[model samples]
Target: MDASDGHADREWRLIREEAWPGPMNMALDEIAAETAAAGGPRTLRVYRWEPRTLSLGYHQDPDTVDWDHCEREGVGVTRRPTGGGGIYHDSHGDVSYTIVAPADELPGDLVESYHELCAPILDAFERMGVPARFAETERPARHQPACYLRELHPAHDVVVETDGEERKVSGNAQHRRTDAVVQHGSLTYAVNAERHLAVFADASVTPAAFRERVTGIADHADVSRSEAVGALEAALADWADATEGSWTGDELERARDRASEKYASDEWTRRRPGRR
Candidate 1:
């Protein structure tokens, strides 16, 4: 992949941000997608959640979350642009990554793009000596309120088999606009699985029941957050013609503006943004 024969060195930047509020993270991801759509270089962004947050799917019912519980627990609240069950990220405990690229760099279809985009995560797990594979079976229709409690969908996440059972280690979701795709996922270093279920009042998601289905890297192996990030960084840079760069002033401003105007706003988070 040199700069010739239509295989030019595709310039992309890798950003490692300190833990940020959920709104900021969502804003930055949207900015990345806008940049890519407007013919900018691809961007790979990684960071952790500060003020630990629970993010709902863009169209997920806000009523699904226990507002009283969230307020009492002092957890942050926001909604992702992608659709899926709500996700709970422990404060400074999960390694989250987002990739924003032009459609040309990804498979046009959503399902295919999930597998293609998730390869780096699978690669990272493998580099850490973890035998992770995609769960190739379609998900059964169960109305679970949290992703960890929901059944695994084919290639929706990276999982490892243990104790004759498969447990998910990472989960990803994507949002695509005209000519850009933004995919984000979390590789959990550790988590209090029982605590996460508290945000949702789903009767079926009990600690003793769903905890067995929820496992992270720390649960199965000695992998550290830095190790996972490093492996993913190498895989991503190799997968694309990424160059080391930082966010420009304009980019940061736009992200902040987006955060305040959309992600952090009641109109967006309280309900489906622009949903008919």
Candidate 2:
């Protein structure tokens, strides 16, 4: 069940877990890359946040958020190891995914690598009867504090065509290590653009305008989390040699340590690290 089985079969170990808090979720994703780099199974993990939370990018300033709104809603906030804009993880409306693989298994070009990892996700959307496609043109950077508020990354988004317009459905970020690559993204079942917009400081986009830029899978199909995961598994199976798997006790312990010592730590989350 390990990648050391020679490159004869590109076996992807899939791990699916229930909703967890922001710190644990982010820590486990880091562990996914570490797991692969050490010659363990390359993994794909899918999970969500409990009680919901707002996850900021590695370099983002927490002070930029409208903390007043976050406190009122009882939402926890933490930072992601990956770089990107902040995202609102709604337990009821979002499903998140993490992909870990040997760097050799992905494209050397970062942009092309985004396309490579996104293929199975696009297939998963298609299986749900949504005709999702990659953004054909480059999107001008938004520099907005929030993720859904930003324009699509020409290479990173999964968009669905609607009435002659292409609306993005997901936002992703990846990190390349010496021997492995880790990418994490979120797919929404519904869009609560208003609630998401409230947390960002001085966001000019209104709720009505925000609705025009993003779409959810529920727009095209209604499937439970398990069903959506099954679709992803089917799609990944088509892309690489894959198998279902579980996490070990040590991975759990390491992840907890990472969460408490890094992700949930004020010093780590508050200050930006150099180059990931």
Candidate 3:
């Protein structure tokens, strides 16, 4: 790997942006990792949720969710393969992406891998005129139920300064296996404070508090959602020196089956792994 150029020894694929329901989105990420481990091209995918979705962290307690609120608001719920806190993904307000490659292709150390994979995301934010960077210091957790409100780490948490305070703009997490790794994250393109808070069981976290803690790209930059997503897609493609690609019909069918069998099931989404 050369530092001066984006090209590397391994081939890469950029699966152009697509939209799917929450369950399908999670299933596809799992499929991507599996394929990459089995000698498929290293993949970078950008996608959107068809409807608003609440994605809970792998280990997050299901008790923290307000099921009725999510139902009344027409919000779909699913659990991510990566661990963190819950995220209320607004269809138009959140830009999500995933990177999948063989474990040996990325750095063996966790922090180093995050920095390498997230470099393009930082570049994308700069392209949007948002001035985003990893948090310089860790912040105390203000809430336990949401990803943005959790304590910030310099490893992968991205922040932007607004009103002289560094507020979070994106959150990234990874799920590693023996053969491959999947890193995915959410960039807050715009904030829907009311709807974001409504999905959680905690009423103490007010909309104003949520706004103060999290900032979006649209908060400081005058870019539309499409432009923001475009910047990310271009940055990611250049980062991996990737060629344009799309899902095979077989991949889509497998993902659909996984979605129905796993992500969409209450048994998987509601139960904490390894616990009754």
Best by lDDT: 3
lDDT of 2 by residue, 14-81 (tens): 77556788999988988878888888888887888986899998888776688778879888789887
For candidate 1, give the lDDT.
0.78
How does each model score on TM-score? 0.91, 0.90, 0.96
Which pairs of residues clash in candidate 2, taking residues 3 or more apart in a chain or in different chains?
none
Candidate lDDT (C-alpha), each:
0.78, 0.79, 0.90
- Cα lDDT tens digits, model 1, 181-272, are 89998877776766787888665655766656666777766777787778878777666657776777898999899989998887887784
Error of 1 at 65 (Å): 0.6
Ranking by lDDT: 3, 2, 1
Comparing 1 and 3 on lDDT, the stronger one: 3
Q: Among these predicted structures, which one has the highest TM-score?
A: 3
Residue 211 of candidate 1: its Cα lDDT? 55
TM-score of 3: 0.96
Q: Provide the lowest-lDDT 10-residue window in model 2.
A: 1-10
Candidates' RMSD to native: 2.4, 3.1, 1.6
